[model samples]
Target: MKNYKFIYVLIGLTFFLSSCEEWLQVEPRQSIDSATALSSQEAITAATNGVYARFRSVALYGRDFLAIPELLADNAFNTGAGNRLVGQFNNQPGSHMGNWGTAYFTINQINLILRALQEVELPVEFRNRIRGEVLFLRALLYHDLARVYAYDPTADIPGVNVGGVPIVTQGTLTVAEVEYPARNTVDEVYTFIYNDLEESLGLMQNFNMNRRPFFVTRGAVAALFSRVALYRGDYARAIEMSEIAMASGVANFPADPVSGWRTQVQPESFFEIVFTTQDNIGANESLRATFMSRVFLNDAVAASHGNVVFTDELAAAFPDEDLRRDLIQRGLAVNSGVFEINKFASKNGVPNLDNVPVIRYSEAITNKAEAHYHLGQFDLALTELNKLRVRAGLEALEGITGPQILDEILLEKRREFAFEGHRFFDLKRLGRDIIKPTGNVEHSDFRILANIPNREIETNPSLVQNRGY
Candidate 1:
C-alpha cells in the first residue's frame, strides 16, 4: 500500500487548526480541496498511477497474494523453513490479518483514486473511460476481498446473508472518521461488483491505447464480469460475458512463441499490470530469479532453503505426454531423486522484466469452460478445455461427463496457471476446503473473509468486524 499516512497526516493537521480557519486560509498549503489538488492532467495521471502502484504492493501482486493464499489454502504449502512470520499465516489470526491488510490497502488506494477522479475535468470520453476503469478496479478488488473473506454464497451457507468487509467509496475523511464501516452482505458486495463491471464494459468499449493490454479495456471488463459471475454461480452470465470478450479478438492468442509467451503484457492479455525490473515492488527478492530463470534451477536462497520444488501430488497429476509439463516445469535431480518447479520462471540469467499478466486469453477460455460445464454443456466444455490443452501441446481429454469434466478442467487450470494467484480462489469457489499441515482445517464459513484492520476499527467505530475475528 502506498502511504496514505501522508494523506492522513494532512487531514489531521487540517483538523488540528480548525479553530484558526482564517489563519489556515492565509497559508497556501491549507486551502486546496482534494478535488482541486488533483484537477490537472498531470495530477489525474498521478492518481491513476496510484492505482497501478498497488499492483506491486506486497498485499496485492506482491508475494503475499501469491504466497499467503496458497499457503493458507490447499493449492500449495509453505515449507515453514524460512520467514516464520509469513509461514504463520496457515492459521486464524495470522491468516485473517495477512489477507485483511493486503485487501484493505488495495481498496483504500482505489477509493482514493475514485475520489480524485470525481474532481478532474478531461475529455468526456476519456473521463468516462477512466471512471469506468476505476469502478472496475474497485469492483475487482472487492470481488477478491469477498472471496477471501466470506464463504461462498452458492455453497456451504446457501443463500446465507453474511456480511463482507466495509465498503469504502470515498477518500474524504479524518483518520477518526475513516477507520471502518459496517460489513456489507456478501450479496450486496457481489451486486456492487457485478454492476460496476457491467457499466465498465459499456463505458470502456471504445477506449484506445498505444499498448494493448496495459490498461483496462472493454475486453478486460467483460472478462472480469465473467469471473465475477462465476464466483456468484451465475454460469449463464459467465458464459455469455466470456464469449463476448473472446469474440472481441482482443484476447486472441498469438503465434509468435517466444515473444508471445515471454511478454508480460501480450495482445491476448485483456488487462495486465506491467512490472519492469526497474520498478519491481514485490517482496520476494528471489521471485524474479526463481520464476524468470530458464532452467528449473533455484537461487541459492531458495534452493538451499528448499522453498521452490513441485509437490509429488502435482507431479503425479500430469500424464507423461502432457507438453505443458515440459513448458512449465523442470525436472531436477537432488539426492538421487527428481523434483520440479514451474517453467514460467524467467529463462537462464535473464532478468525477469516480463510484465505480470493479470488477465489473459487463457482465463477467458477457462472461464468459458467452467461456465459451460455448469450449464450442462459437457462436450462443449471439453472442447474449450482441449483448445488450451492443444495450445500447450497436450492431447485432448476424452469420455468425460459434465461433472467429471469440471474436475478435469480445474486440474488443467492448476497446471496451466500455477503460481499465478488463481489456484486458491479456484479451490475455494469449487467448495474444496483447505486442510492445513498444521492440522487446522478451514471449512466454508464466512470466517474466510478477513476483518477490517484494527487500526481502521479503532478510528471508525462504525466499521463492523468480520465474523470470527
Candidate 2:
C-alpha cells in the first residue's frame, strides 16, 4: 500500500519559532507577500488547494489522525503489533497529545488560508465558492476538535462555561506571543462551527463544479449542516438538512455495504480528499487495514502486525442476516481460536485510494433518522433507517414504537459506522459512557479530554487545557 503524502505545509513548533523572523525577512513564493497571495484568482485557488491538502496529512485526515481517536475511544483496539505509537495511544495522556497535536496542526492551516483569503480578489461567484469551501473546512475541523477535547455540553459541562480548544482564527506569532485565553465555552465553539457552515451553505448554493470526489460541493455543505445540527440538538434542522443532501442524489450506498465501504471514494461520497496510488497515498495502508486479523481473506502483508479487533458487543449488534457482519467483521485464527476485526478496506495493492470521504449522503440519512426519532417522529425515523437496511441486504425493521425505534437507529449507526471514526463522537455527544477497556494500564483517565500538547500550550498561552487532563 502506498502512503499518501500531504501537500499542505504544517505550521508546527518549528514554524511558530521562526514565524517572526520569516515574516520579517522572506518574501512569499507567490505574489509580493502573504497579503498579496490571495489577491488573485490563481493564488486564491492555490490557497484553497493548500487547505484541502491538509486532509491528506498524517496528523489530520492522514493515517494517524482518524486512527488514533477511534483506537483510544474503544470502537477498535490495537493489535499491540506494529508501531510503538499505537501502543502509546492505548495509554493515557499520550492519546490526548496525539489527538490535540494533529487537530491543531490542521486548524492552523485553515486559519492561515482564511486570513489570506480575505485579501484575494475574484468574481463574486468564485469568491463565494472559495470562501464557502474555507468556512466548511473550518467548521469540519473545529467540530472534530471539540469532540476530542471537551466534555458533553448538556451534561458534564455547562453550555456557557465549557472550555474548548482555543479559537485560532489567525496565524500564530511567537512563543512569547502565546497569550492564555480561557477556553471558549463549548456553545461558543459549536456556534462558531454552525455559523461557518451556514455561511458556507449560503455561499455555495449557486456554485457548481465538476463532480470531483476530492472537492467540496453544495451537497457537502448540506451534509455538514446535518452534522452541525445534530451536534447542536436541532433535530428539525438536522432532518431538513439531511433530507436536502439526500435529495441532491449524491449519497448513494452500494448494493453490498461491505464492498461499498472498501471503496472509500465512491460516487455517493459527498466530499472527500482524493489520493492516488502513484502519489504514495496507500489506500491499502490505511488505519482500517491495521486492525484486521490474520484470518480475514482480504488481509494484507502491510497490515500483518494486527492491532485492534472488534468487541463482541459491537459485533453482536448486527443481525444474523446482515451481510455487513461478514463484510466488516472477520475471525482471526489464533492458538486460542479466533478474534474479530473490522474489514472496511480491502487489500487492493494500490497504496493510495482516490478519496477518503469527510462526509457522505448515507450519514445524512442516518442523521435524519436520529433527528426524527428525537423529535418524536418515530415512524419517520424508522422509515429513514430502513432505507439503509434495504441497501444493506437486510429486512426492514418492524413493529417498534418511537423510543424503541430510536434505540434501534442508534445501534444501527454504531454498527454501520463502527471503526470509521464516528463511535467516539457519538458516544460523547449522546452522553453515553464508553465501555471501559479492561486491564489496560491507563484505563480510568481514558475518558478525560486530552490536553493540547506542551508545545502548543507553551507557544499559545491563551489556550486553556481541558479539565482533568
Candidate 3:
C-alpha cells in the first residue's frame, strides 16, 4: 500500500483553474474567506454554483461514478480487455481513490457553502432555494459514498454503529473537526441523508421549480428520498415518496430511444448534470470518449481508440423489440458486428456535450414496484413493471408470481438504467453475487464493495479498511 499525504493544499490551489476541456462553465474562483464571501448575495450565489462545478469534476460524475459502475457490473465492458483498470474493478475490485477522495473533497466544498450561507444576507426565497439545492446535492453525494464505501446498515455484519464513511458536515473550523473525524454508522449516514432530503423538500416547496434539469428541484428531492428509502428497506416510504415524485410531472418514459435515453433531459429527467459546447470535457475523457465509437463522438473514424462498449451478453439480455436496444449501437461491420454504448453520444452534434442524468422518473415507478414486491404486494409490483414495459410497447408481464416478480423487476431495471450506475448497487442490495451476463466473475465472491483508499487509512489511523481487502 502506498502512503501519501493528502495534497489538498495543491488541490485548493487548482480548485478554480479550469481548462478548456472541463465540462462545467463557471467563472474562475480562488479560495475566499467564508464570512467575506458569504456576506454578499452575489458571492453566495457564486459559491452555490461552485458546488455543481465541483460535482461535475472528472473524479466525480465526469467519469468514475457514471461509467465505472457499468464496467464493474456487466452493463459495459472495458474494450482494453483487462489491459487497464476497469478490468481490474471487474476481475478484482480494490482501492478506488478517485471516487473516494473526490467525494469528500466535493463534500467539503458543499460544507463551506452551507457554513457561509448561515451568515449571508440574502433574500429569503433566494436563500431557501440555494440552501435547498445544496442540501439535495449533499444528500446525493453522501448516498453514493455510502453505496460504494460502507456496508449496508441492514447487512449481517457483526458490529454496532460500524457502517459509514466519516460524517463531516460543517467545514473544518477546528482541529477536532478535520484531524480526528471518525466514521459514522451506515444507519447514521442514511439518517443524515433522509433528513437532508426532507429539509430540502420543505425548503424547495417555497419556490417555483422553473429551473433546467441540471439544477435540483422539489421533484429531485422526492426522487432521491424514494431511492434512499428503497435502499434502506423502508418499502412503504419508498412507495410513498416515489408516488409523490411521479406526481410532480417532471419525468416520464418516452417510448423511443432517441428521446428516452439519448436526449439528456426531456420530460423524463428529474435532474441531469449538463454539458454545453462551451463546457464540454473534451474528447479523450468524456463519456462519449469512453462509451460510443470514435466515429460517433467526433466522426474521427469507424473505430479509433474504441474504449468501452456493451458486451454481447448484455446485448442479448434485451428483447428484440425493445427500444433500449438502440441504447446499444449495432449494425457496424467491425468485429463481425460492432456494438457500442450509444446512449451518451453527442446530441447537439457537438462532441462530448451530453448531459449526465442524475435522477429520472422511470426509476420512481420501478422503485415503487420493488417496494410493493418486497411488501408481498405481487400484483401491484407486476402492475408497475407493466407500466414501464407498455410505455416501450413491449408486451405486459403476465404469469409472473412470487420471487420471479422480483427477478423480473431487477431485469427490467438492468434494461432501463444500465450504464447509468445502478447495476452494482442493485445486486449488492439484493444480496446477489456479482456474476455478469458473460459469466466472467468469481462465483459466490463477496468483493462487491470498493476498498477504502489506502492513503486514507494511512493518514487517519482511526479509519478502518474494509474486511478481506
Candidate 4:
C-alpha cells in the first residue's frame, strides 16, 4: 500500500511536469492509494488520462504499431532514407517489434487503476465509464501482445509454436510482489481478452460518453471486439459485434475517403490516438515523417526521411482509376525516385503531426466480410465486401464465390489499410506466407513469431524464448 501511494504521487507529479512522457516509463509499482490519491473523482480522472497518454509513444500506435507491421509484411519497402524500420523490412533475426516492455508497463497501470476504482466510491455513472475504458484498454494491450508474441489460435504451427505472452493482471510494486511468470496458451490469452471486453461492454452500457473516436466508447469497444473475434476465429461473434459497432453510430465511412485523409480526425475512426502540438513527435520520428517525404501535405519541397514507401507490387494492385492510388504519389527532391505514401500527410495542419486511427469503420466491414467468407457464406461475403468495393470506386461483384472471394477480400484489406498497418497481421492471422521483394517467408517458419525480449528470458526462469531467438 505504501508503494502504491508513492507511485501514484510520482504519476501525478509526472503529469504536471511532462504532459505524457516520463510517467509511462516509470516502473509500475504495486497498487494505488485508494484512500487518498484515488479517493476523489478529479484524481481518478487524472490517473485515467495518464493511462491514455501512453499511446502516443513511438513504440505504440505513434509509430512502431503503424509502421513495423507494414514493413514486416509485403505492403511496404524501407527506403533506407533513415535509420529506422530497415531491419523490420528485411525480416532480420531478432529485429521484430519491441512493444513488450511498454505494453506490459501500461497493463500494470491499468490493473492498479481497476483495483483502485473498486475501492474508491464515486457516482455509479462515472465509475462505470472509467472502469469500462480501462478494461477495454487492457483487452487491447493483451490482444496486441498475444498476436505479436504468439501465433494465432487458428494458425499455430504444431511443433514450433511456443505460447502466448505472459498474463500479468496485478500491478507489481515491490520485489516481493514480482512474479517470474510463464507464457499462457494462445487460446488462454485470447479467452482472457474476450472476457475483459465482454465485461467492459456490459459496464459501459447506458454510459453515453461523448469523446467519440478520440477516447474509448461503447462503439469503439464493439468495433475492436469485432476485430478480436475475427482474429480468434469466432465468425458469428465477429459478424455480430461488427453490426453492433456500426449500430452504435460513433463512426461512419466518409463519403469521400480521398478527402477524409486530409481531415485532422479521420471520419471513419472508431478509436484514434489523438495528438496535439504539445504531443507532436516531430519530423524525425512521427508517422508522417516516416511515410512521407514532404513535411506537410502540400509542401513544394520534400524535406524529411520518408523512410517507408508502398511496395511496387502494392502500388500496382490499386488500379489507375482507384482514388486510393492517388494517395501514393511520386516523391520530390531527396525522395524523388520512389513513390511515397501520403496517407499520413500532416492532416493536423502541423508538420509531422496526424492523429493515428487505431480502428476504423471500414475495418469492421472488412472483418465481418472476411468472417462471412470463412463460414462459407460466399454470397453473404460478397454482399458485405461490395460495400468497400463500391466505396473505393470499383464495380460491385455479382458472381464470385469460393476462394476467389477470399482473395479479393484479403487484397482489399491490403489496399484499404496499406499504410495504416493491417497487411502483416491480416496475412499472419490467416496463416499466409509473406511475399516480399527481397524474398518469401513461409507460413510455418519460426520467424513468423517475434522473439521474446532476451532480458525477459534471462531474468525469469519460467519464461521461454521464441524458437529462433
Candidate 5:
C-alpha cells in the first residue's frame, strides 16, 4: 500500500482530459500540479474521463486482457516472431494477467470520485449519472481483480482456496490514510459487486443519457451483472439480468459478422473503449499489431509482429463456410504458413486503431444459455445457443440433454469469443482443466490463480499471497 506513491500522488491531479464528443476522445496524458481538485462538475467530469482512459492501457483492454487470455488457454499460440507472449503461450509460472497494480490505481481514482460526488453540488440528474458511472466502473475493476487473484466461488479448492483481493472502498491519498487490508472472502467480493450494481441501477433508472456503447449505461450495468452472476453460478440471477440487458437494446448481433468487425463501433458492444486516431498505440503495442500482420484487412505487407496466431484446435472449431472464418487471413510471407486473426484489424480504418468491446450482447445471450442449461432448461438453453450457432453458419442442435447442452454452450462461447479474452476465465470459473497444446493444466493447479504482486505482499503485512506463489 505504501509503495505505490504514484497512484496516491494522482489523487488530486487532472491527469487526463477529454472532450465530451459523441465518442469519448481521450487526450494525451499530461501531469498538472497536485493541488488540482475535483470541486466542481467540470473537474469531476474530467477526472472520470481520466479513469476511463486507464482502460486503454496495455495492462488492461488495449492488449494484455485480449491477448494473454488466449495465450494462457488453448485458443491461441505465440509465433515466436517478436519474442512476445511466448511465456504465456507455454503457461509458464508467473506469466499471467498482471493488472493488479493498474486496476487498483484506477479503483482508487473511482473511489475518490465517488467521495467527491456527495460533496460537490450539482443537479440531481447529473450527480446520479456520474455516481452510477463510477460505481459501475469500480465494480468492474474489483470483479476483474477477484477473478484473477482468487478462485471463483463455484470452483474454490477445499484446503487451497485463498481469499479474494482486498475490498478497498475508501480513497487513499496520503501515507497516514493508507490501510494495509487483507483479502476478503470470494463470496464477499461478489456480493459487494452485486450491491454496487443494484445501487447503480437504482440511480440510473429512467435517467436517459445518450452515451451508448462508449460510456457506461444502465444496459451496460445489466450486461455486466449477467456475466458476474454467471461466473458466480447464480443461474436464476444470470437469466434475469441477461433479459434486462437484452431489453435495453444497447447492442445486438450484427447483420453481417465480417462487416461488423470493420465498423468503428461494435454492433454487439454494450460498453467499448473508443480509441481515436490520436490515441493509436501504434504497431508495437496495439491488438491489431500483436494478432495480425497486416495493418488493414486488405493489406499485403506485414506491419507488426503478428506474434499471436490461432491454435490448431481453435482453427478446426470453425467450419470452412462459416462467416466468422473470414475474420482470419494468411500471415505475411515471412510467417507464411500461419493464419492470423483479423478481428481487431483496423476497425477504425486506421492502423492499430480499434475500439475494444468490454461487454456485449453476445455474452449476455451465451450467459443466459449456460445458466438455463445448468438449471435443467434444455429447450430454453438451445434456443439461446442456436442464435449464435446459426448466426455463425453452424447447424443448430435438434435434440440434446443434460451435460451435452452445457458442452455445446461452452463450445459456442469459445468459438464466438475466441480471441476477445474469455477463454481462460470461462474454463476456470467452471472448474474445468485448461486444455493446452503444451499440457493440460488441471483446475487444481496453483498456477490457475495468478501470484499477488511481490511488492504488495512485502509492504502490506496483512496481504496474503496465493498458494504456490
Candidate 6:
C-alpha cells in the first residue's frame, strides 16, 4: 500500500498528489506521506475523492469501458471508415484490448485509501463509511476486469482452473510484489470480489454515504450484489438480494423517466461517477467526441462529435413509443451516411461532461426480473419487467409465462440498456450466440473473449492470453 500511496489531497475536488509522475511505474516503495493524508477525517475524504478522479479517466467508466462494449456487440454500428473504435474490432485483440492500465490504476488508489483508513483515528461513522465506499469501488472495478478479460466462471467449457485477472488486494510497495504475479482462477477472483462487497455491506448499513448517486450506498451495495449474483448464475441469491435492494428503496424509477438520461444525476441512479467542468474529459476526445454529433436539436453549445451510430436494427427494434427512442437522434456521421445514437450526449449543455451511471434502479429491476425468471417465478418476473416497459411508455404484455419469458426479459434488458454498455456481457452471461445482420459472429467463438493486452503479456510472462487472439 505504501508503494502506490501518494499525498493526494483535495482542495474543493481538485486533487493535488505528490510524486504523481511515477504513480503508475514499476519501482520500489517511496515512503508515502501517509501521516499527513490519513491524519484527519477531512484528509481521508480528500483521498477518496482522488479515487473518484481515477474512475473518471478515459480508460475506465469515463469512456472506453462504457462505450466500447456496445461496439463489440450489436448495439452500435460501424460508420464504415475512420471510426477508430470500430477500427479497433478490425484490429488485433492483443493491441486493442487495453483496459488493464487504467483499471488497475483506479484499483491501486482504492487500495491505498483502504490501507490508510485502517490506522486513521477518525470518528467511527466516518471511518466505516470511507472504508465501505472504497471496498465497494474496489469490487466494482475487479468485477468489470474479470468479466471483460477472463472467461466467465459459468462458461460451459471451463474447468475450475481457468485464469482471471490478478487478485491484488493491497497496493504493492515494491517491484517484486506485483511485477510477476500470476493470474488467479476465475472462481478465486469472483470470490475475492464478493468478499469485499459483502464486508462493505456490513459497514454501510443505514449510512447513505452522501445520500447521492456518486457514492455507493448500502442499497446500491445490495443492488450490486444482486447484479453479481444474477451474472454468476446464483439465481436464488439474486432474487433475495434484489428484494432487499427494492425494499431499501433503490429500485424506484425516476419521477421523470425521459429526462433522467439527460439529467446530470438521474434520480434512478444508485451509483454514478460524476464529472464537473473542472474535471470534465474535454469535447475533442471523451465520450461525446466518440458517440454523438452536436447539432440541429436547438442546442449548438452541446453539439455532438459523431463516432459510433445506432444500427438500423437497434433503431427499428427499439419501439417508437418508448421514450428511450427519443434519446436516439437521426443525424449524419462524419464517416458514413445518416445515422443515430444519443445515449452518451451531453446532459448539461457541455460536450463530454455528462455523468456516467454505474448502477441504476432499472438495472436492479432487470436483475430481479431475470432472477425470478430463472427460478420459475414467471408471474413475478413479468411483473418486474412490465414496470420497465410501462416506464418506457410501452404497454405491458399479458399471459407470457413459462421458460419462454426469459427471452422477453432479455429483450427488455437490451432495449432498456441499448448503449449503456450491457450488450456483450449480457450475451456472454446467457451463453447465446451474437447475431448482427451481416455479422459473422457465432456461438463458442473464441474472439468473443478479448485477449490480454500484448504489453501486459510481455511484462509478465506468467500471464496467459485468451484463446484465438
**Candidates' TM-scores?**
0.81, 0.82, 0.89, 0.93, 0.94, 0.87
Candidate 2, after superposition: displacement of residue 410 in Å? 1.8
TM-score of 1: 0.81
Q: Which tens-of-lDDT digit does each residue in 92-151 have in candidate 5?
A: 889899999889878888888888888888888889988998898989999999888899
Best by TM-score: 5
State the lDDT of candidate 6 residue by residue for 123-147, as single tens digits: 8888888889889888888888887
- Better model by TM-score: candidate 2 vs candidate 3: 3
Candidate 5 Cα deviation (angstroms), residue 93 = 0.8
Clashing pairs in 4: 29-172, 29-173, 30-173
Worst 10 residues of 6 by lDDT: 5-14
Q: Compare candidates 5 and 6 on lDDT and give the better one.
A: 5
State each model's CA lDDT, in order.
Answer: 0.62, 0.63, 0.72, 0.83, 0.84, 0.71
Stronger candidate by lDDT (1 vs 3): 3
lDDT measured at residue 434 in model 2 versus the true structure, 0 to 100: 60
RMSD to the hidden true structure, all candidates: 6.3, 6.4, 3.6, 4.3, 3.0, 5.5
Residue-by-residue lDDT tens digits, candidate 3, 1-469:
2212434533452452232223122356444443345556666666667777766776678766777777777677666632434544455656342577777766776786787677766688887888899999999899988988776644535542246888887765433445546788788899999989989999988443577777888888899999999999999999999998888766666666456554546567888887666567777777776666554633535543346676777778888888767666652334226577777777757767677888888899999999999999999999999987876658998977999999999989988887787886787677666766545553234455677877787778788777667
Question: What is the clash tally of candidate 4?
Answer: 3
**lDDT (10s digit) by residue, model 2, range 235-339:** 898988887787765566666676655554565688876655533443234554455544234543333544556655666677788777765544444312334
Clashes, model 1: 14
Provide the clash count, candidate 5: 0
What residue runs in model 3 are displaced by over 4 Å at the alpha carbon? 1-35, 81-84, 95-97, 154-156, 159-162, 173-177, 255-257, 262-264, 297-300, 331-338, 437-446
lDDT score, candidate 4: 0.83
